[model samples]
Target chain A: MRSRADVVVIGGGIVGLSTAYHLAKLGADVVVLEKGYVGSGSTFRCASGIRAQFTDEANVKLMKYSVKRWKELSDELGYDVGFVQTGYLFLATTEDEADVFRRTVKLHRRLGLGTRIIDMDEAREIVPILNTEPFILGQWNPEDGKASPFKSTFAFLMRAREMGVEVHEYTPVTAILVENGEVMGVKAGDRTIKADAVLNATNAWAPLVNEMAGLDRELIPIKPFKHQLVKTEPIKPGLVNPLVSPPSWNDSYIIQDAEDGGVIGGAGVEHGPTYDVTPTYDFLREVVRWMTRIAPPLKYVHIIRQWAGFYAKTPDSNPVMGEIKYVNGLYIAAGFSGHGFMMAPGVSEAMADLIMKGRTKVPLDWEWYDPHRFERGELRTSAFQIG
Target chain B: MQMRAPKGVMVLGQTDGEDPRENIIICRCNEVTQKDVEDLIDRGITDIEEIKRLLRIGMGPCQGRTCIPLVMGIIARKTGRRMEDIKVPATRVPIRPVPAGVLVGELDEE
Candidate 1:
């Protein structure tokens, strides 16, 4: 049996759903296919950290637009996205690190991002528990915040559906029906969805879809790494903002979820030789060690719960967007490197523009983030790629 | 200790009818009930693997970190097997949750 639609979007993650949502808003007949329940994949497990801190102007611009959309999400979607503007604090413990932060903040200021390089004293005022003893400088962006990935994606999906997007969950894309060197549609189970355009929005599983569509391309080698999040029992004192140690000491950050009265936090623990999202005793130990070092009051707090999520990696540690070279009627928007949840809205908008109107104001035309950049032998490294 | 019987198997010490113990939840994320587990067991899902496959009890984001031990205990009590006799689910590598940012950074470095 076969079904047809104007567009068939594979993968129901935030990126896929957001793309479907935008396409629907553009008055296109769209259908979303998913192998699992909504937000159950990488989206559900996301840390939900949204930040505008980026080394690339394109990423900064996209994330800035995302932040704008996030600000209006509650009104736009008619649901609370749990978007809290607690801000992002990037601490630097060394002079070299401070220099890098200074340069980034200057660029951010030029873009009117309102980020500043503050001293230990100002950083202390924002997050009182920060271990200023080890850090001399910090990059403080008062606008960066966190939100619930589930709620945000749900909002988008709901609003998108209201705008006439059809979504099918637990429907796996068995194959891509391509002919004459172009994508015809997608086949899910025994159902074939015919469409003039196809989008490969599956994040970690992007390479498989690319191969299925016969695109001579692969995602940015997004290796799935696991990290654990531990939540402490309710305490009296509350944290005001997110805290991140110097990139050298910790490759991750922690945030306080006052909604549940628990200090929910995690770090980018070292990855092993494989892609597995299992928990370990060593992770629990390191989490306690670091949490204690950062927030002394948390040392004695009993850990009530813990869970793991896979971090998808890209080669440049930035999201890969825009059209692929060889495959027509096919677009690629994967390899977010763990920043996809927050960047979904703006990224999807840009992708929708490129798909519908052929050009976008979202500045995604960087040669570094080019879809075939690796094949073209061009790689630009960005320094602000923190977990 | 709360002597509530494991969700579905009815291991000798459970409250009567309808409401099971709120604290005794199977698959913390999905909240699969004790009755849910017992139904799965009665339907020939006595083994942990089969139970997980049928009920999706311990296959959530936690990946059986907390629920597996309890599931093993339940299976032990019901099948007259030791807790050690019940095998733990397979543990894979990258044995911690990671942010996508760090994962990508590591890949870029490689």
Candidate 2:
């Protein structure tokens, strides 16, 4: 069986669904294909941490717009993305680190962001259990918060459908159809999908999809890195806001879920040779050590469950966005390195605008994130290096 | 976690201070066997990848959520497989199970 659509999205993740939703709003016939359940990829396993405290101006602007969209997503999608305004508290345990925080805060404030640097005492007041003895200053942004990645992705899927987007879950793309060195569509199972435009938003599996399309693409610089986060058994809430560790170490950040009392925390773990998402004892031990060091209250709290997720990393640790140069009708929106969940809303919306209206109004510089940047020796370094 | 041992499978681990011969298993996700794992190397399924394929040690719905560590310990018992050889599997999203029906319901097909 052969099908035709105005646009065929290669993956049914949050980014793909959001793009479909926006494209359909512009009256385009969109079809989304999924290899697994919707939100089952990186979307469901995401930490769902949204913030505008980024060091890079482009990232800060992307997040700033995304935070706004998130605030009203419930009304837009008719389902809560679980946007909590609990705020993000990034602490600086040393004076030199404090200087960095101050510089970041200045940039943030200059951009009209409500981020401010506060003393350790103020930091302790925000998150009561934070041990300020090791910190001299902190960055506070009351607008930053965590959300339910599952619910958000699901909401986008539902809303996209309501806007007339077709989604096929468990339907893997067996191959991408290209003719005369241009993408024509995709082949899923025995069915051939003829598409006018194809968007690849497969996240960690972008490389595989690109290969299936037979494009001479070198996403060769992109690889997967494993990261693990755990939730402790429900206990008395020790912290009111998210606590980002001083200088971003293995125990990068920990925050209490506002909807569920479970504490959500992340630890940095290295990638193995093969694609392995299994949890590790090393991560558990290091996370515990840092968690206890920063917040003594977590020492006795037993971990209830832990899961690992892969951050699709590029050579520069930044996303590879924009259209592929050789693939005439193919667009690339993958490689978000651990920050996909937060960046999806804005990136997807931007891609949708660029595809439908031929331009994007968002502050995102599509040129900087071009898929051909690596070949041209251009790389954008990510500011946040920790988990 | 309570695990009923599958047929022809021997229970492994501390046994929670209970009888080791009882019909109870350590990892519940994949019905792996202590004896099956022990015989893995002799059966030519020596490495972690081979063990994972032979006995379904790390291929369950949880994707070795509870059992990978146990399998790692069993592999660690053998001095041949280095500590670094027991690397963790790649973590995909939707950590917990979600209804496939919900995903299907999201699409607006003709």
Candidate 3:
């Protein structure tokens, strides 16, 4: 590992690697430190769904840009990331939920996203086995879809390595070296690697790193929430083409991978902050119940595997980015809640621009995701946080 | 002993001079060939889980029972890792396949 670099990113998940790759592309000396093997964290466990049908304008814009990047990612990275634009179908059971979908679709279309509200018949046409009895309508975005998380993460890692970004695996950052409220470097094991800037891209574990940087809990307030998912044995392909989510069904989602023919689905369960990633019977039952309700044919399907991971949740369900106000050169890009994988492409580029040029040319509502928002008591309304 | 083929019948082990290894199916449920596994391994995807996610190697009805060890051997051979050191994929719940209907109970009960 190098003893010094222009910037040191403190994580090696998709976000960190993509950011490192982008930073290296910008001609910055970058080093990525991973506590475990690359993508062994939440990236490996993620559902890998990418979408832009968000209620918030900023989120819509950001994800639309991200989807655009995902479309071209395979060519850009010189590796197929398995990106498929099968679309994302958001089901609505109640009038209130339908109203939210209506408004979100309007906002999405206004931002040049071709998301539209579809009737029950159209929804059934998209997913032939969809249980339309539970959902009155669905919001469909054909531009949004799913990708291979492992492929994308490895793509970025390989490209970053090719671009001379040094990556050290199984090297945990023990401390963020702060002197007089200015970032110096990080302490990993017995060595100290001096750096001009340090970024806390350790999503679920961002709080621990932030605290190490002397940021108070009140100032950042990022918490980890455990989310569980299950994969069913491969059946015939095209059973469920799009990523389907019903907001009323515990925020459940079911999508079948076209390449693999395995049906992957999950649901949210109310839980406090935790680091536990053990798969639970309760989560399995809940996901099966909700998924079977969404698509009754899934009841006959057999679950092959189950796992859990963390969503680095902030109060407003938005990420905290940008440099720490009182601490110079200490930047953070964590607290993505559950949408980091999809937002990675755009986030990495914007974050790279921020780190190198001190501001991002990529248009996004920067103030809403400002690292000082918690301190200033300026939390924006939560983004659409469906599974 | 040499087996003689009938006038219209082909021998069991004969493939008309094709590569016999191409007929070796590592994952029968998915029809994944030995070459498929080696091709991915050649691409630097040595991890079993990453290979599974990308190629759908052991994601079929048998749930990796027949192919996991075979793929592990291939990876161990290709990556120079010992058989014991190659990480296995996680075995998930129900152990055996349980129908989701059984878990959710009767439809009328809801």
Question: Among these predicted structures, which one has the highest DockQ?
Answer: 3
lDDT at position A208, candidate 2: 87
Query: Which structure is stronger by TM-score: 2 or 3?
Result: 3
lDDT for each residue of candidate 2 in A243-316, tens digit (9 for 90 to 100): 46555554367778665565667776666433677788677666666666677676555555567778888888
lDDT of 3 at B45: 59
Q: What DockQ was computed for model 1? A: 0.04
TM-score of chain B of each: 0.67, 0.62, 0.74
Q: What's the DockQ for every one of the candidates?
A: 0.04, 0.02, 0.48
Give the C-alpha miss distance for residue A201 in model 1, angstroms. Answer: 1.0
Model 3 alpha-carbon drift over 4 Å, by segment:
B1-24, B29-52, B56-59, B107-110
Question: All candidates: CA RMSD in angstroms?
Answer: 8.8, 13.6, 3.6
Runs off by more than 4 Å, candidate 2:
A217-220, A237-240, B1-110
Candidate 2 Cα deviation (angstroms), residue A132: 1.0
Once fitted onto the true fold, the runs of candidate 1 whose alpha carbons sit more than 4 angstroms away are A216-220, A272-275, B1-110
**How many Å off is the CA of A152 in candidate 3?**
0.9
Identify the leading candidate in terms of lDDT. Answer: 3
Interface RMSD of each: 11.4, 17.6, 2.3
Native contact fraction (fnat) of model 1: 0.00
